[model samples]
Target: MSALPVIDIHTGAAPVLRETVLEFDQVAVQLGGRQILSPTSLKIGRGEFITIIGPSGCGKTTLLRAAAGFVRPEGGAVLRQGRLVGGPSREVAFVFQDYAHALLPWRTVQGNVELALEAAQVPATERAPRAQQVLQTVGLAAHAAKFPAQLSGGMQQRVQIARCLAQQPELMMMDEPFGALDAMTREGLQDELARLVRETGLTVLFVTHDLEEAIYLADRVVALRANPTAERPSLARVIDVNLPRPREQLATKEHPEFLRLRRELYGYLGHGHG
Candidate 1:
């Protein structure tokens, strides 16, 4: 098998060939009379898989939502391809954790995927083929006629992912997408998602509480802290996962670098740091 075109981000050198697709320039968010996310700054390169991991209420979801233009920031700005993102666009796709609720019960897998193209005003003649293509990409072409209720949890999540792919978004914002699945299913979906990202070169911003998951999926992990003050800001630390691509659950976890990263990030969570 040919090697996947994975970016060598752990080299600690700037990737001059890659372009910055999303940028958060001192972005801050406030909710319900309290600051949810303190001014945070980061640049996401095209095709970068960035995972945001922190404590339960560290505004990880808020940061992802802000990037999707669902939450308005109280300060600073979010830029997409050098342009400021004022509102949601088709270029940005969001995947929620609750796959059960995210998919329409009335619609079949293919129909649900069609909704994305329909919303984008894709020609009626082009919807079916596009939907089927994405379904096949996610390994769900055989189950396209099945409804969300009829499919398993992992299959239902694949439908949601296919729908996102149908939209052909430049950036994918996923909020704990695999959190609801069982351990084995979660690992399967992780490998599948990594493969999809490698094939499509999609830039993803995923939020999760699982440290191992973060280390496994991310090129760089951003750890956030809640209730930020000037002394202790929301952006805690950003760690580079230097492990090579095509990571396996058994072999990759046993690697020395992965062990060191796991140990390093373990201290950031549940250690009164966040």
Candidate 2:
């Protein structure tokens, strides 16, 4: 077998066309004789944050999974660093929509994060410190010994993120990770997640139903077509967000470029121009 490809995320110093990290070449997916994703194509550059938005059942999550090797397509290819992906490799980590199912009920927050490292075959002696470091990164250091039952919903999701961070995967695939949280908590974690991505230089492929969330977090947003199983899902044009980095939620949202991007993103999802 050939070596699994390792994708490099661009840190914004060079032009996008010169540093394409992830590419989809006329990719299509189907299940039970019904088409899920249409002939979609995109190239995600290194260090770029991409958010995918659409109505429910629009194959946004499926496309993210395909890139993570969870959903293999019936046609076309997903290339990482210009090489085809065959299966689940260590280079990718997926944060599921359901945090309750994603975390282990019996494991403490630290143990859960440690388990990810163990599964990745990280040595036993190195696991504790690695887990602790990631927990710090996600701002869950105090809850290390606490079980999932002891923490609130948002904290549990942080533990989930810490686990993924512990693995230190090259490409992070998130499927509505904050969808289940309340408004305040959701906003807080959204900022935290953006900070983590920027500080750690991790490339993200996030799937969300919220257009505002897409505008706030993504360097570019890709909108999907609705009713994926009934008809092939399509990719609307990529909306570029060139807002200033290290963005604050309130300030970034208030910016003119942010509003313009939000409006364009909404329109792509079949909303209005005004």
lDDT of every predicted structure (CA atoms): 0.89, 0.83
Candidate 1 matches the true fold with a TM-score of: 0.93
Model 1 segments beyond 4 Å from truth? 1-15, 271-274
Residue-pair clashes per candidate: 0, 4
Task: Give the per-residue lDDT of model 1 (tens digit) for 214-235.
Answer: 9999998998876787567799
Error of 2 at 232 (Å): 7.3
| Candidates' RMSD to native | 4.2, 4.1
How accurate locally is residue 268 in candidate 2, as Cα lDDT from 0 to 100?
A: 62
